[model samples]
Target: MTAKFIVIEGLEGAGKSTAIALCQQFLTSQQIEFINVREPGGTPLAESLRDIVKAEHQESVASETELLLMYAARSQLVHNIIRPALAKGKWVLGDRHDLSSQAYQGGGRGIDRTTLQTLSAMVLKGLQPDLTIYLDIDPVIGLARAKGRGTLDRIEQEAVSFFERTRARYLELAESDERIKTVNANQDIAAVHRDITQVLEYFFQGLN
Candidate 1:
């Protein structure tokens, strides 16, 4: 099988972690060689950027600054981790990717979509996930789940309206993209996994 990149994207508390774990198990069962990674992470420099982005800063972080930092981190992860793993014929499973920036910065922060697209094209250089599993959920419920888990991070602490916009962008993009598969994460855990399993099976069938 050709090496493929799979990404899971969604708002906070959308069960991305659990979905990723499920993918890992599925890949393991199929004896597929794969590496799991998270956006703004999976590399030393990228991890640092993740910290800065998530940290509560005394000085307000400018939207442009945050956008640049996200690209920088993505550049590192793509160059140092994702591409290399794919080159070695290993599948790459990601917790998030370019779409997150489009939704969070472009939609939530109300940045220009063209700017975000230009940055993504430059940094990614045509690289894109073979499959993107988008866990869809209401912002209100998702935010509540996140709050119940623990203290929210800088991005997670954004207003509910911000997430509402983010979710809207996510759905809009997913609907237009053939590579993206939208799953109803509002369903019970087992039901969600069953749907994910169905998606993966269909994707695998297409691969063959």
Candidate 2:
């Protein structure tokens, strides 16, 4: 079977980590070889970019600048890690991808869609996730969960309204894209995992 790229996307504290773990288990059970990576990371340079993007800065960071930095990191990750793994016939699982940018930067930051599309076209170079599982949750609940983990990052520190816009955008895009699957993440942990299993099994069947 040809290798596939899968991604998990969600707002902060939407249980993406848990969902990703479930996906990993599912893949392992199927005896599939895969590598997992996170966006703005997976390579030395990209990891550095991740730090810059996450760290609080004295000066306000421009939205456009943040968008550009994200794409640069994504470019490095795609060329150096993602594509290479797929070429070696290993499935690639991503913690986040360009859709995060489209939702966060475009919807939350109100950046121009044209700019985002241009950057994505340049970096992705026709590559896109074969499947994306978007864990959906209310911003209020998600933010409370994020706070429990510790201090919030720069992006996570944004107002709840920001995440509301981001969530709206996520749902809008997910509805329009068949490759993106929405999974309710507000349920009990076990219930969420069960839903994730169903999503994965459906995706696997499609593969055959």
Candidate 3:
């Protein structure tokens, strides 16, 4: 059987990493072969791209630059990690993917959708996630969670209003796409984990 690609997406501090971890645990217990990875940093070169993009500075990285950098890293990730894992019939779990660009660059940075689509098509080589789990949380709450951490990246340093737009866009994407599932992130940690697992299980069960 061919492996499935599952991408977990959300605004900053929406507990995407934790939920991804939980999802992986579920797959492991069920004896499902899987490969877990994240975008913009999966490959060594891509990880370098991540540092260049995330480093705090006031050099004014344009929205297009952000989009391109993400695609550049994504291009490398697909070739080095995603394609091989899928070819081996290992389900691939992605922490974040193209939708983040749609939300962050298109929504937060006010970039045009047409350009994003064009760039994505060019770099992604038509690869798309089979299932995208969008963890939805209010921007205010998400920002607060992000701030609780020790440091902030260039993108994270954006104003709260930027994140507000980003979160709204993420929800918009979820509503418009059948493959995208929205999971409320405002609940207690365990509850959030359970809800995410239920959604994943439902999807995986459908595959079988």
Misplaced by over 4 Å in model 3 are none
- List model 1 lDDT by residue over 1-208, tens digit each: 8899999999999999999999999999889999999987889999999999999999999999999999999999999999999999999999999999999999899999889989999999999999999999999999999999999999999999999999999999999999999999999999999999999999999988
* Candidate 2, position 94, lDDT: 97
TM-score for candidate 3:
0.96
Better of 1 and 3 by lDDT: 1
- The estimated TM-scores of all candidates read 0.99, 0.99, 0.96
What shift in Å separates residue 124 of candidate 1 from its native position after superposition?
0.4
Worst 10 residues of 3 by lDDT: 56-65
For model 1, the superposed segments whose C-alpha errors exceed 4 Å read none
What would the per-residue lDDT of candidate 3 be over residues 16-90, giving only the tens digit for each residue? 889888888988898889988897789999999999889875687777788888989999999899989998899
Better of 2 and 3 by lDDT: 2
Compared with the true structure, the alpha-carbon lDDT of candidate 1 equals: 0.95
Please give, for residues 23-130, the per-residue lDDT of candidate 2 as tens digits.
999999999999999987889999999999999999999999999899999999999999999999999999999999999999999998898999999999999999
RMSD of every candidate to native, in Å, equals: 0.6, 0.6, 1.1
